[model samples]
Target: MSAGDISLVAGTAGAEVVAVAYRSTTHGEVHATVNGGHFALWFPGDELRDGATEGVQLEATFRDGSTATAVLTLT
Candidate 1:
């Protein structure tokens, strides 16, 4: 799946989500950062491994002196 098809759905605005980051838990250790909205990640000459799980962590700082995080697992 391309990064463009990946998305994070969060609640209404309390914090402005600036970006989403991803890291692969396999060899080559690929990392990606995408815009807060829908986006795509493409690695030329390498297909995203099947069954290669990725850990996704989100960082958000709220206007109310609060912080939030969302963790996601991708297969």
Candidate 2:
């Protein structure tokens, strides 16, 4: 799937998103735009391992000092 297909939302409203990391690699802030309590992250197509079945961890950091993680399994 394209990066545009995925969207992220912060757990705490009004919190500013700091960063989003995938597979231990931190993407630049330019790839993630924070809008209110939600944000969208764009990842490089190659980073997703297109045809592989794997569970990738997405770590999100907020300016409020809170962090959240989610695992996305791609087939």
Candidate 3:
């Protein structure tokens, strides 16, 4: 598997990325985190690993209980 970092800029600073996961139909959550909002989680090459790739969905839950979602890609 290709190990890499998945960097995310939480629009709301200090919200604390409570969770970084990949979820999809017939699949479950793979966790990651944030350290100072950069170089956080190492993307676990597998789509269902601790990270995701193109077309996979990324769901981020914040400390405030709010959440955000995005498709995994490098573009």
Candidate whose TM-score is highest: 3
Off by over 4 Å in 3: 1-16, 24-27, 39-53
By descending TM-score, how would the candidates be arranged? 3, 2, 1
Q: How many clashes show up in model 1?
A: 5
Per-candidate clash tally: 5, 0, 0
Q: Which ten residues in a row have the lowest lDDT in candidate 1?
A: 6-15
Give the TM-scores of the predictions, in the order they appear.
Answer: 0.29, 0.42, 0.48
- 5-66: candidate 2 lDDT, tens digit per residue: 43232232245667665452445443445567665555543555542466656677778778
| C-alpha RMSD (angstroms) for model 2 | 6.1
lDDT of each: 0.41, 0.53, 0.50
Clashing pairs in 2: none
| Better model by lDDT: candidate 1 vs candidate 2 | 2
* Residue 24 lDDT in candidate 1: 41
Per-residue lDDT of 34 in model 1 = 38
lDDT value, candidate 3, whole model = 0.50
Task: Tell me model 1's lDDT, rounded to 2 decimals.
Answer: 0.41
Error of 1 at 57 (Å): 1.1
List the candidates ranked by lDDT, beginning with the highest. 2, 3, 1
> Lowest-lDDT window of 10 residues in candidate 3?
5-14
lDDT (Cα, 0-100) at 51 in candidate 2 = 22
User: Candidate 2: misplaced stretches above 4 Å?
Assistant: 1-19, 23-31, 43-45, 50-52
